[model samples]
Target: MDKLAELKQGLEETWHSLGEGWRQLRDRASEALTRFTPVNRSRNSLEDAHSPPALASNWGLLAGDLYEDGEQIIIRLEVPGMVKDDLDLEVRGDVLIVRGEKRVEQERGHGRYRVRQCTFGSFRRSFALPAPVIAEKAKARCGNGVLRIELPKEARARGRRIEVRSG
Candidate 1:
């Protein structure tokens, strides 16, 4: 085989791997509550674990749940190692926006890191609400590595048909 053809084949294979990884991540986004960072083969093993790689994607699942129960909409997000002050929340139109930065805590004593699996940085996740909600009446709380929010669904207007008479 020619050298150019060999290089093209290798590039195509790499792209396929990247596409599959991204597809799996997106497909399981709603159900999985774990974070993932695909190792960049091009970079040396000594590089930073948090470096932005393939497709300029950072790492953080920020998994959460959104559901409606009767008159309210409930949202729960897994945000371990954080307090209420570390996160931010907002309601925009039919979407709920959650933003936060996860900073790595410093240890008391000096020690060299042997293993690192955590991804830290700013992340924003937006969820579309199934029903309208009253943003002013929303209440949220963060505790036990989880953030829970409840928004009272807006009262939907009832439908009424007007009778028409021929003149």
Candidate 2:
């Protein structure tokens, strides 16, 4: 029975080695897949949270939402880590343009960073209004890292009914 016992022990060790090899293969495959996958800024919020900043590109991505409430179109953007003075807003024709620059400050005495994810760069986001707005009367406010832009729709764009006249 000595030979049989030795054979059984050898088989157990081989099984464990095979299991480890499978685990390593799975981990390597998962990392390769993640590296190749393209991240969609609009759909994947969690990925954006952990993703490193787009340093290779000149322009950084800006996330925002546009909606219409009553007679006004409200646009809210997430512009964290920036001051109001760094932003510029303009209305040209039917397009509302927002331009801003985010500067990243690094102290000289600070220790090395293992992971830097905060994005810093110039970004421009332009939105086309659904209806004509009074450009001169537009109002914008930046508070708590959120930029709110309110544009009032033109009087003509508001639903108006014309009386039917019998010929």
Model 1, residue 150: distance off in Å is: 0.2
Angstrom error of the Cα, residue 50, model 1: value is 15
Each candidate: what lDDT?
0.73, 0.69
Cα misplacement distance, residue 50 of candidate 2 (Å):
22
Pick the lDDT winner: 1
lDDT of 1 at 141: 97
User: Which residue pairs overlap in candidate 1's backbone?
Assistant: none
Query: Which tens-of-lDDT digit does each residue in 1-167 have in candidate 1?
Result: 69999999999999999999999987877553433333333443322344434423345567788877778899999998989998899999999988776765433334444444566556677888888889999999999999999999877722245899999
Candidate 1 residues lying further than 4 Å off, grouped into runs, are 1-26, 30-57, 106-111, 157-167
When summed lDDT is taken over every stretch of 10 residues in candidate 1, the lowest stretch is: 38-47
